[model samples]
Target: MLRHFAHPKRLTLVAVPLAVLVAVAVTPQVRGQQGAGAFESSDEVRAAIARAERASKRADRRAQSLERAAGQAEQEAEKIASQSAALAARIQETEAEIAVGKGQLQLIARQQRALDARLGERREPLIRLTGALQNFSRRPLVLSVFRPGSIRESMYLRAVLETTIPQVRGRTAALRAEIDKSRALRAEAEGVLRKLAEEEDRLSLRRTQLAAIETRKRLAARRRGGEADRQEERALAYAEQARDLDGLVDRIDAAGALRDELAELPGPILRPTRPSQARASGTTTRIPPSTSRTVRSPSGLRLPVDGRTLRGFGSVDSKGARSEGLLIRAGAGAQVVTPAPGRVAFSGPFRGYDRIVIIEHPNGWTSLITGLARSDVNVGDTLAEGAPLGVAPPDGGAIGFELRLGGRSANPLDHLSR
Candidate 1:
């Protein structure tokens, strides 16, 4: 009787430590995933892959759409810049989505591996239980009489076996169900991985195409290397003269402030006259000067692009780095426009900000737009309210904007109309 019970008792002791070990091992990972994002189900993984795939497909469509739009663009620079920027952005966005899809696939693979191990751990106990049940079944109750135990003890053993058989069956059924689920999960995970691979391939193709375009552009830019070198030397001289970005911006803002202040002053005006009025007046009858309306307020300005605001001023990302502006996730190939009239202070790439456009508005306010693939406006250009400044790549990703008052960054929400 002791021998018959020994295996199960040993299994119980083993299971306790095994379960504890598993808990100890899994706890950190579970907490890590929780901190990363909510755990994803198989369906969720598939959905993420689908979303990424869709984004790639959209990027393809966007590239073609931008090409067609560029053909109709007003200026050659605008056309080439528009097409290049949009293509580059679309490629970047698709690459990011593909990366996310791959991450999901990896997560699913880990879950599948863990589940397989769990099923494996249950196998030995299940085998022993099944063997014991089969042995008890083979040796009928009549054989207990031949065994070396009291009749009462035999009866108790029989009763205990009868109760335990049902419990074992129930547990076996549950384990089997779980095993089936794990298998299904693994199958689904495999499918997700395959889908992600296909997406990665598609993104790779887009990247290749982007590379070809950039290669051509680089060749063109190299043709201007001589002039570019002189310009670079001048810029370097200025940078060395200014010392830092803040000082450079301050110097630039100082010049812009002078222009803005002079613009605020009334200039000498000479009204035109018709010949009939000139004859009647002996020389000319001056036309009435149109009264200029004051634009003193920074209210009622519209958003630069139509999209959801992902992050606001002071919001931090996964790296805990706070934003200095509003991050908007806009439509693929969407046009980014000026929120208000301003003079383009700088329109070129800045480190980490991508293609950017900075416009100095009146009232000491300057609007900085970033994350564009191409800048439409150039420095010293006057952009009217809602004037197109740049273009987003197809498969629209993040576009950031900062509202600076006197060179100090401020929350754009506070200034933009609701």
Candidate 2:
């Protein structure tokens, strides 16, 4: 019997179960330390999840707000400018929805990866134990009793199995839970993908509508003759003569001041035929009030685009010069709009600034926006507050917006509506 128990095959049978028991016992302690480390790592993931959720919620709220604004603009649409503004708002709303979808997808992917890792860690020992148990079960109990020293070995094996099988079952149950979570994450990802697709479709449609409106505006401007063209030419000539961006702005402001002065001049007056008859009439000639009304400052100002402000007025820029404007990091093709009611003083490309729009507001307030893919409005076009100005570069670039009062830079944030 002792010799039978000493056989290599029988020893292997005993060693396999004992190895499984040792592995099952030691793995938990090692895994406990690993779990502590994992917990620390997971805390960071949780924080990321929280941030993603907050961003998603904010995007949702912004999308709803823009949608409402779009609807209102559409209802009030009487001109091509108002129609363009409505379409711009819709495009921005769609972009916000797309942002929410992307955040959700990132959150789902992180959760899925974590669950997959947990399941992988739990399955390794279970796989080895499964093979060993299968081989042991194939050996008949009656055959074990027939072999020398087999009865005692089988009984000892049964005792080991009784002690260890419950722990294995517990591990399997936990693995099942992780698998369910992984499946749920996949389903959530699919839903977010579908929503993202819908938002992209809406964005495409809104852009098409805006393009049509812009085409109509261009045709109308062409029918109005070459006055706008001559003004644009004059503005471009000024841009060529200016030394820098600020110089170009100062020249444009000077031109706007001249234009306003010319508009305020009174028309020709008629002379009376008879001085004696005029004295008897007792009627006096009255002059018109000044058309260029001045205000203390621009009011109800807001951001021209939805973006993160990277540099504020007075911040140092990459060129080692103090910034006189806001540099905003906006998404590709983001909508640009007027922060206050104004007339387009210059709308075209200038030296190294891409397409730009200069708006002259009441009370000597001027807004200069640079870095655009296209300019929709023409020179001398009167725009209401929140009217669509144009779009940002398609490749996702920074936009520069400078607000000047009497040719001096002011912090735009200070004047923004609360």
The most accurate candidate by lDDT is: 2
For candidate 2, the clash count comes to: 0
lDDT of 2 by residue, 288-318 (tens): 3333455455665767776657788898868
> Model 1 off-target regions past 4 Å?
1-65, 71-78, 99-103, 106-167, 221-231, 255-406, 412-418
Tens-digit per-residue lDDT, 1-418, candidate 1: 5455444644543353344334433432211221124334656555655655565565456456666767889975456555664665465455546545564655656675676577668767655655664555455455567777745675676567646655665565656565566656656656656766785686577556655654665465567547655544543444456654456566666666665556666666556566455433456434322122243445445566655578989998999887878888765556576767777777776656677776777667777778898776655555544455766877777888877766667777777664
User: Candidate 2, overall lDDT?
Assistant: 0.69
Tell me the TM-score of model 2.
0.73
Compare the candidates by TM-score and give the number of the best one.
2
Please give each candidate's TM-score.
Answer: 0.50, 0.73
